[model samples]
Target: MTNNVVIPSRCWCGKGILTYVSKTEENPYRRFFRCEIGLKKKKEQHLFKWVDEALLDEIQRMHE
Candidate 1:
């Protein structure tokens, strides 16, 4: 999928985004943005983006 990262300010559910570090073995210590409500209800569509990917998108935008 194309990178549409833009440092999301909010989720479609109208809640503020939260930054959290991953504690799983697959993605240990990786930071990501997520909607608080989505964390409670795992089986729902919500905003979730990687901090590093978002920053990379920002840098790419600057060059373009």
Candidate 2:
């Protein structure tokens, strides 16, 4: 069997999983990722990434 390293999509904090949220007003229907612990600490800097941006980055990496 071939060995393959697996990578996680969650935050490095190990507190919660990545959550998908849809922006409905300013950026209607745009999807983004956030950590589940956002509700507990409003000021905490958690994972916040845009789905489109992440996809674009991945595509770029594949071509490199």
Candidate 3:
């Protein structure tokens, strides 16, 4: 038996894990999470979320 509790930090692509990276431009110094393969130049659904924004959305949902 395996416990498959999907972590909130994982990418939708089951294969790739989300990683944190600091933004270099735009919102410089801000951190975000994305699928490790997001760096690849391919047309696929990848996870790219700002840490702050994601947290806010979750909080909002909780309050609702």
Q: How does model 3 score by TM-score?
A: 0.65
Q: How well is each residue in 1-64 modelled by candidate 1, as lDDT tens digits?
A: 3566488999999999999999999999999999999999999999999999898888888888
- CA lDDT scores, all candidates in order: 0.92, 0.63, 0.64
- Lowest lDDT 10-mer window, candidate 3? 1-10
Candidate ranking (lDDT, best to worst)? 1, 3, 2
Q: Deviation in angstroms for 40 in model 1?
A: 0.4
Candidate 3 lDDT, tens digit per residue, 3-22? Answer: 22223556667656655668
The list of candidate 3 runs beyond 4 A from truth reads: 1-7
Considering every candidate listed, which one attains the maximal lDDT?
1
> What digit string (tens of lDDT, one per residue) describes model 2 on residues 1-64?
2121122267657765564668667777887766778646779887677777776766666676
Q: Please state the error at residue 35 of candidate 3 in Å.
A: 0.3
Candidate 2, overall lDDT? Answer: 0.63
lDDT (0-100) at residue 45 of candidate 3?
76
Pull out the clashing pairs in model 1.
Answer: none
Better candidate by lDDT, 2 or 3: 3
What is the C-alpha local distance difference test score of candidate 1?
Answer: 0.92
